[model samples]
Target chain A: MPTLPSLRASGGDGADPGRDEVASLTFESVTKRFDDVVAVDALDLEIHDGEFMVLLGPSGCGKTTALRMIAGLEEITEGRLYIGDRVVNDVDPARRDVSMVFQSYALYPHMTVRRNIESPLLVRKYRVDGDGAPPRKLTKAERAARVDEAARVLGLTELLDRKPAALSGGQRQRVALARAFVGRPQAYLMDEPLSNLDAKLRAATRLELVDLHRRVQTTVVYVTHDQVEAMTMADRIAIMSAGRLQQVGTPQEVYDRPANLFVAQFIGTPPMNTLTGTVTTDGGTGPAVDVGHGRVPLPPGLTTRLEEGRPVVVGVRPEHLALSDEGPLEQKVRAVEWLGHECLVFGAIGDSPLVVRQTGLARLEPGGTARLVVDPAHVHVFDPETTERLP
Target chain B: MTAEAVTSPAADRSPEVPRSRRRWLRRYSPREVLLALALLAPSIAVFVVFFYRPFLNLLNWGRFESRRNGAYFEDVGLAQYREALGSDDFREGLWHSVQFVLYTVPAGLVLGVLLAVAAHRRLRGIKVFQAIFSSTLASSTAVTSVIFFYLFNPVVGLIEANWLNDPDMAMVAVSISSIWQNMGLSFVIVLAGLQAVPDEVMEAALLDGYGAVRRLVRITLPLISPVLLFLLVVLVIFGLQAFAQIDIITKGGPVSATETLVFKINRLNRPDNIGIGAVYSIGLFLVTLVVTALQFAILERRVHYAR
Candidate 1:
């Protein structure tokens, strides 16, 4: 083992002698408190190896704090956290073998892109999983080759000599990614890395990040308030609000079956429109919710789980609401937004506003009424008392 | 101008904009430029009367060499400039000034940065320490020199050191006072610079696995190099012009070993050697100008200005 002034991960000669085995990150009953306020409360999650897990929430929902805890930037007030099999509750960030990309890109402005990418390898030891082949420092040539490969991977080869101040926002973002992956650390933690990019570039970079994750195949715990980024890039999305984890599942699963009202409203574009109602037995035809201007049927399977004439809040997504001439619900159209391929018809039932998505042009006008229907399969029922999902 | 003049242009675009209003948008109107000049008139007048006038007089007087202890004079043109500058007295005085700068500048900068970095954290009552560090700025240079003079006194003094009485150590003793006196300004400026560095950059470096020392050397120092360079230029200028400490502490004593260029110039206030004093004064100005210019030329390129 050479002295630790130089280290090379994934050097060309010894590249992938064995595949870089990644580590799963787990948090058990984790809690974080600041002064008097609880920032993250009893967070329990297991982000598996090679998984692209996104922590999705609104701002100040403890998403960034959770990611920082994984990076060892913040202390967990209670509970055990694990990277792989090690309980890294007291481990230093550097020895924990995880890397992070900050929202600001946090590139060393004075160093060239090459040096920025090569910095972690120079300082951190190679393969620090605390087992298998004692950790050793890398040689200089190996470090250089690893930097070259990272630069090539992130399309930063031509910009290696330039400082961060010289790069555009997107280019700086790539430099940040290159720096994070160049060391091949066990896991990568990102906190809203694309929030600074323009909308068009953000969309493009979302795909680029997903592709990078596929190639790198390392565990990623990404934190963001933007659902679009989470939906498009995450293998799983963990939704949080007000310092507590609401639910965690595959993106589609969370989108289709939110565990609570917060997850339902926070996971979709235009969000889920929830109207309060009372469940009725409907002459034993099974339960239905009388949602003010219309009575929408509940899933017949929910009859055994539901009570008669019980108070409930029914949720339906905008895309689930279809415009039908014979539909029972009468929605007074307030506005219509034509989005080329489809249109969003924003209308209301009495006082509750509802958004309905219709294919092609919505030949509807403001101040007119829209007849809309919601399928029972797409309707989500929640317990009005606790705001939790009703089975 | 009308209240909505700026905002109403788009609303009334079809109406032709007056030429003067257009010029104001481009940068400034002629009337505004005149007002700016008028505002600067007082400061310009003061500089001309008190600073530039005396400076020009000194330059002109450098052309003549005094004869017969100011009873007579001889116009030697550039000859006096050459001869007075080349004289051993002038050389020795300039050497002493340079020595004083070398003793004070680096030590002051280092001590300032150390103290600033120490007090820049978020510990409870840290503001008290910051106040203590910057308290030296409250004292006049004479007060600081007098305090040190008594502290280093051989009899009835703090440590009883004889450096002030020894010719070789006299400049070092005086520089000690100067460095202490200049430290407050440096600490305040450097602390401001350190505070301006975004906390996120340091956090990023931490996640990048840089230890504390490497983070300071590689990230912190380079990011604040511009501010450090500014501190250097200011300290260098103050060091070159140093006089009050010398006058109060050692009075250019110990066989005049501590007679810096400024001290010597003041000593030549008599009618006899004012010509030589003018020449040394001009020499000090040129040296300051060149040193500052050299520092900016060499170091400005390395400074990283955050975008």
Candidate 2:
């Protein structure tokens, strides 16, 4: 069971997650509406101490809005936010003690990297010295130490003197990271941090970010549209759609048992195939679904409740489809992508196309006929109207 | 490389270059340049005939000073230049102009930045405020001077300030009027610069825990440096050419306290010192040239354009 309680026993969950003293961040039914468009609608999320949580969604799905709300950059239309036990809804972003890494890596264009990273610390608070009418400015040595410490944290020591325009994209990202980490805030809010990098660079930065998270051990709320990024980096992913949370679970749980059709379709590559079918009783075993031209047996004990011909959607991942010389359902191969070690054959049966992943270097042509056998145990039935998974 | 190499050979393509270039130039024609040349040609021709030609003639004319009724006509080569350069009046006018610049430029820059920053936000009815702030652009220098003249009138003035009448404050009064007229231009320039900053940059700064003041000081100011430099250069030039404000309001009176270089040059229009006026005009031109060049040299290095 990948439940919160078990996670706590492993030192993965913080005690009293809603309490600001225990959790690094908490959103108590936060809602943000912009010009009648509800960007974030009654969202309740908590990031415990030392956890990496990714907010995953497609565009216009409110993930960015949720992250901004946590950063105190966006006004929370309703609900309260807490950082380490303090209600930060009315607090300005500067007082929130949370830092954000922007998608554009908006480095201050005028300042060198050192000055940029040092700006937050320098402006954090003002102090008056003994009998001094005015506040004392930071000493050169203090500023230098802070800059060096922050730069070392983000591996940006060599590039501190350079202007942002002079640095490459990856270096600019590091500078952005350095800027965020300089203050040593309680949490980090990263909005699509690696979306701008090339594929290889994205992979490399992903690993670096995980390692950095391990080293820093600070709570993080990462927002990304890429599910792979969400899955690879997040301890738990909160998937959103249409300004509503669709599902929240570990990578494998969401993959194996998605809450709805959107999550099922969104989390996988070459997505799960959904075929319209009718649920029929096959002698006391759970309601068997009669897919067109063949029947897929269901799990035990659902036969009596469901009617013989209730419309449903059968979802089976491509890898779960086994190929055979003489299977129940036949398909005509539409295309064949032959990797060196394995092959993926895409085919159409009746009116629906099926994707089958098979191991080995078997050559299948576009016109060839093949059999696709669905595993009864792996097959899932979803309610067509509600789009929720049914037993 | 493959895509380009597949195209027809350069010999065939090169022949069409001039034709397409000419067509492009024709379609997006430089109307401003043509209009500028058209309008300036007649003025430039008139200036050459009436101003430059007579000035050159006067430089020569000074060598042979003509006097009627028993006065001798003497030829003194470069003597008038030496005397004008050495004169206390020329030095006085130079100091007055420098003082005028000191009073006007800084005030204009500060007022412009303040108004621009205030009106740049998305406040309610802000557009109306911006329109009112820049409304001074509608008034000419002479009109502005006349408006301020009555406003600062000692007895019947709206402000009830005697500073305009006092020699100690005459330059400051005239600078106030000039600032009033020029503030609008400054506001417009700075506001445009402020508005041109991308919102993402500001949001990013906010997310990085920068307060409003830090963001403005560190990000907004630097991004708008080019505009500030432009406003500075224009205001300095306007400061140097402070004529109508002085002419209509002070008339170079109150013990010549408000007499700028242009006013001094205009004063040289008197029959006896025509040659000296040309010297002042030439001197003003040199000062403007040097000031503009120095401003550009010093400020250009500081402004960072998004490359």
Candidate 3:
């Protein structure tokens, strides 16, 4: 409920409540190229300690590629990777103090749940000294205690004896999470870990993961194509397209003030409507957006910066649109979708169809004409050709 | 109007055909069937001719008895079976066969797994190593036995080892030849299995903090059990049916120390005692069948298939 900048200024108390900085990872100009494809292009970001950061985009957006670079699973073409303080660009994946939960869950199909969890501890003991190969011996008691503790943390005590194949999808994901968290790595890299789960499970696990991040205080960089996952689970969301980062901000920050045209449509439910218009100055009064239907006057103080008669895009969220008896613009309703709490009416404005969200119920029918008005303060303007936000 | 519309021919025809039944043949087109049959036919024909036909002939030949030394003769119906089944010749031959399996199976499995694990990973010039690992497949068992026979020849061999004549080293020499001839196969099979494991699983293991050794013991081996089981079944069969190595290298000689069941059967190919030889052949067949079946029963539970 607090504003982003104010929240940043305040002592750290998030949904789960705490102020301590946990695990942090920094990537400095990380670039990874695979043969002809540039998987990651000049990516620069900081993941705050214990922050649940979601790298969200459509397929081939380089989200997975970025996560792999952080995990030391992929070679970084050009950049510095620091887990806490140490640069691990040359470190082997086995030595990197990071764990990854793959989209497929990647549960070792042959091993029992306990073995899978214990495997990390064994690896740690062998590599922790950083002298030689794995530890040649592990006392049974030490192995048992480690497995027991991890199983308890993941609520998998009863399923320790079961093979990965026998466990349910949710259980398998937990095992994967337990595997990742068993060694208590500095950060967790999850590559669409819940993408394989059913819709209901994904929702439940999303909440669980947020809570887990709070309790563990480990920085997590999660990759997902699902926007809802990004909105609900991430402390900060980084939206990417075509291997380039479009924007990074809190959920509300992204929704209220998207950096570009791409971010405007990428975030929020039902997407924002974009209308091509011309910015014109009338005498010396102010600049006005002329969107074919009618002219909507902009705030006078900000109008002088705008070029006269320049092409621009007026963006408005669906929820900000109001249906009125005597509104300025008229559209014929093409379809209506009734979501339990609200109704969304879709209508055509010239060649483009626009989405409008109305609270409660709507007594609207297909082919009916309605007057639509959007709040001026809630609208965003972008340079039409460049697609950059217009101040 | 609604009643008439409900009785339309299109509506009636829809329910007549079962959707699932229609899908049965449609799932695979004619081209798919042809492709599948084309791939499978050669192996099926070869198994019938080389394996089943010989097996049936051996079974039938085990009947009837005849003169072996020209002074002794009999018309024994399955009498040769009782004689071959109970004779010292059969017992000693069976013992040597078991000894051969003991010598070859474990050595083959361990070496195969070692080589496979070493070469499964991608490294500089790894493809060349992989090709070299499987190069043994080009040499026949006879060729390998001959090579070892000369390598370990007592008086004339280049090495001057006398391995074939020494009682302690005779079985060991035969085992070495068998291992050399068979290591390539086990390596190839296990390597294929290791390669088949999804990269995500290993990454998960590595991230889990499992070093290479723990990962190999806990994750890698178990995941590749199906392949290991396949190697076990194949290598054990090869060990049990070993003959060329004993024949060319030791000739089942030096007091029958290196004689395997197959080698003993080969010696039974005397013209007069065809029936007795048939009995030996049948005995070898039974032994191989029982051992293979027992192995499957025991090892099937240990194999963990991902799907």
Which predicted model would earn the best DockQ? 1
lDDT of 2 by residue, A1-391 (tens): 2111111111112433332224468889888999889998888887778789999999999999999888777889999888878898899887776788999887888889998888766766422232233434457676677578667655577778889877767778888887887665678899998988778768767877786776567788999999999999988899999888888888888888888889888988888887788888765345577777666666453333567788888888888888877576677899988887878888876788788888985567789888777787677778889998775
**Would you list the rank order by TM-score, best first?**
1, 2, 3
What's the TM for model 1?
0.90
lDDT for residue B20 in candidate 3, whole number 0-100: 61
Candidate No. with top lDDT: 1
Where does candidate 3 chain A have its weakest 10-residue lDDT segment?
A: A2-11
Candidate 1 per-residue C-alpha lDDT over B1-307 given as tens digits, one digit per residue, 9 for 90 to 100? 2212211212212232344655445777789899999999999999999999999999988877789888877778889889978989889999999999999999989998889888988888999999999988788998998999997798967766688889998998899898998899889999999999888789888877788888888998899999899999999999989999999989998888999999999998777777777888899899999999999999999988887
- RMSD (CA, Å), candidate 3 to true, equals 10.1
- What's the distance in Å from true for residue B66, model 2? 6.7
Candidate 1: residue A381 lDDT (0-100): 91
Model-by-model DockQ, in order: 0.27, 0.21, 0.24
Query: DockQ for model 3?
Result: 0.24
* lDDT scores in order: 0.85, 0.78, 0.78
Candidate 2 structure quality by residue, lDDT tens digits, B82-136: 7876789988998899999999999988898888998998877999999999999
Task: Give the alpha carbon lDDT tens digit for every residue of A188-282 in model 3.
Answer: 89999988888877776776777677566677899999999999999999999888888889999989888899999998889998888788876
Predicted complex 1: CAPRI docking category: acceptable
Q: How many residue pairs clash (N, CA or C atoms closer than 3 angstroms) in each of the candidate models, in the order given?
A: 0, 3, 1
Error of 2 at B196 (Å): 3.8
Model 2 stretches astray by more than 4 angstroms: A1-21, A125-143, A282-287, A291-305, A330-333, A338-354, A359-362, A367-370, B1-77, B154-156, B162-164, B198-211, B269-274
DockQ score of the complex predicted as candidate 1: 0.27
